[model samples]
Target chain A: MNDYLEIFNLKKVYPSAKGPQTIVQGFNLKLRKGEFVTVIGHSGCGKSTVLMMVAGLSTITDGGIVLAGKELDGPGPDRGIVFQSPSLLPWMTAKENVMLGIEQVFFTAEKEERELIAEYYLTVVGLADSMHKKPGELSQGMRQRVGIARAFALKPKMLLLDEPFGMLDSLTRYELQAVLLELWRKNKITAMMVTHDVDEALYLSDRIVCMTDGPEAGIGDILEVNFPRPRDRKAVMEHPDYYRLRAHLIEFLEVHAHKKKPASTVPAASPAVAVAA
Target chain B: MKETLRKLDFLLLPLLGAAVITGLWYFSSATWAGDLPNPTKTWTESKPYVLDPFGKRGEMDQGILRFTWLSLILVAKGYSIALILGTPIGFFLGLSKTFTKAFDPIIQILRPVSPLAWLPLGMVLFAKVKGVNISEMAALFTIALCSMWPTVLNTAVGVRAIPTDYMNVARVLKLSRWKTLTKVMIPATLPYMFTGFRLSLGIAWLVIVAAEMLTGRPGVGGFLWQQYNALVYEQIILCILTIGLVGFVLDRLMSVVERRFKTA
Candidate 1:
């Protein structure tokens, strides 16, 4: 399952008043099947631009993505997306919102089966009680739960998240992270998440791809976390290597991510950063 | 008890307002040679029309109910025609900039022109459509053409106001254009469309009264004109109440639908 998801030399340029402004350039990543990856960067670092290209929701000015064996031409149900805000249809109940995506993805599935699928995922996200409530009627956390439920119900080949909990409070964020981690472990679906929180990346990802700030941003360093599976956050935090990795990521974000010329990082297999004095 | 009181608050103000208005109306209309009929006088004068409201009392004397129904039918047919034509055109105008650029100016210019002003055009057009001199067709055309503005404009505005994030959600889901329209555009625009509908119905009601008065049609508006010509002040007052009450009911109906869709 190597190269299960391949993003090669991706670039994005927006038409501006002066001229075309590049947002993501030479951005690259590869994921083996079932590996959870998170792209971490500062605001305006084009992490979302990168994830959007993978989701086939944005125009790819220069590069391409190959998911499994198929090239992504445009948006399809193959890639599920969970956005930062609760982007559920305000008019539809949480259950109905999930059902809408499921119906679109599995158009041929029986109505009863689709209802069951929506119910199963909503229940998974602890939203079974609120599933019948509309987006406006639910709390932000409950709304995001519906969003996560909708994406998971699609059962897509890959899930792309655009800081799915960036707006939530820290406590709510932690609760949602646990729910998401449990779901990811159960399904083992290849996923790429965009985030700013270093702890969040370390908590959820098997690999962390840190990115530099962009007019043309690219990957700064790829850090692999080899902590054992069915991991406990408390146990992981107590481990010395976890602190090492955490400090490593924070440094990259502060120094490497902001410095703009992080293209000189060591090879991907080095497992360490060694620059000449 | 608190919930009951809260509900009662809604009706209290309206009832008080109505009572005040009625008191003023009676106090004014009770004066000698005021040339307006008091409520009691109108009720007494309307006893024949009210007792047998649907009666076939000769040609000019078709009862109040029959006249009201005829006027209502004209408004319904004309308003229905307007909705059927206006909504899609408005939606397309909202979605397409070029279409709006070309068509919107004409719509704007035509929108504010009073429904009464369209009488001449309706008369000319319906005098004989393809050599067919149709009775009541002219007034119907005038009513329809005049009242179609609100739904069209409001629907367009509704489409314009849809949040971009919702469209992004639509794209990420890869929903079909049909689904995007039905699931996104229609529901999102429903409240706005209802606003337009209420306005359009009001305009249609106004236009129907004026149109029927001129067309010599057997309706409330025509009846009002006849009673005016015969110097029957009480019947004229009754006609005013009939028109006001019906208009209020029509507006209320639309608002109910609006509230349901909005809060849903």
Candidate 2:
């Protein structure tokens, strides 16, 4: 396949009292199957907007998204999304929430088989004990775990997470990130995430695609991080190439991207290289 | 002693207020030579109803419980009809902005117009049908007609108040229309629906009295009218007390139901 996921000259404009306002323009991206990519940008830089377009949740004023060989008309069962909040139904138990999505995706499957699949994914997210708890009763991290379980149980061809742990504490964020990493390692499904967190993008992503600020934001930089798989947080942080890549991304955000801040002073003369381990 | 006091917290204040009101009524009546029956006279007169609540003597000797139950039964039938018809319309109004924009003005205009205003029309429509008593039918139609608005409007408002995040989740899941309605929309709207329901049931009870009074039927309202016409002030006092107490109980029943049907 030329590209497992392709966004060709994507554009989005929302109509307002001031006439059409363009949020994104000339946004081009491509992803290989099983690639973990994160889009980073300033707030209101249209990263979430672009992700919404990919998830087929928002209308693309122009351009198109092609997944595998087919173009998307609208949202379908093939893409699973996790939002910033857990987004589990307050009225439903975690197990029921997972079952709801899995049952839809595996509509032809027997009821027992779907139930097992739901339970299996919930267990994978370490929510086996709390599977029957409603969203409100569960803590925030547990709720997001259920959200992740619900998304994964659908067995979508790709996973799309829009800052799924943005509202979480750092410890909980790390915990969920590890859980997601384990699931991704086992399933090897393509993943696309949107985050403004530089360390989060670096720790979890194979490639980080950063966008300039909107209105009319588009791709500014694409960095490939080739740290070995089954990576640990401490191990990734200790990698020789990690700091170089981090500094480059931070520089891009501060200088080239909109909303410039006081430059983080870096060692003057370091060889520019992408360490493809 | 503390436990008893805590228990008394539930009963004491309300009981005290009732006693004070009764004392005031007695004091007022003793001082004034008027038709308004005092609390003691009403209690003495309604002793038979309190003692044998299910007694029946046709129009002249019906028990207080029997009259209350008759009104309640009519309320049950009319309220069911209201829910059946009103809930679907409310859902449609909530779901479609165009429909809401078109029909909301008409609803507002008609809502404030008392359901009693429809009595003549109901009389014409429910006129002496085969297998149906015309007066009873008219009373039910009037009560249902009035009671439905609160439910319909409340359900619509509830549906509209649902957080957009839930709808976004629905969209992302690409849930089928039927599934969305059953699983998401109905449950999400339920809390608000209950508020509307409590309000509607109160109004239903309120309108039933007027409906029965107008139709000259077998209910508490009709009994009140009979006592009024007969100039039996003590019996009228008894009927008024019965109506107030029944209305309070109906409201309390709705509160219990609302607590039981929690969304979370």
lDDT (Cα atoms) of all candidates against the true structure? 0.84, 0.85
iRMSD, model 1, in Å: 1.3
Tally clashes: model 1: 0
Candidate 1 lDDT over A1-277, as tens digits, reads 5889998899899888999999889977899999999998776677888887887778899988899988789887788889777777888989988988898888899999999999999999998788888888899998999888888889999888888888788999999999999998898899999888889998889999998867788998999988888888898788779989999988887785446545444222110110000
- Candidate 2 per-residue lDDT, tens place, A21-61, comes to 89899999999999999998766667888888998878889
RMSD of each: 6.5, 5.6
TM-score of the first chain of model 1: 0.92
In order of appearance, the predictions have TM-scores of: 0.87, 0.93
Tens digits of lDDT, candidate 1, B187-237: 889888988888999999988878887777778998999889888878887
Candidate 1 stretches with Cα past 4 Å from truth are A256-277, B1-44, B130-135
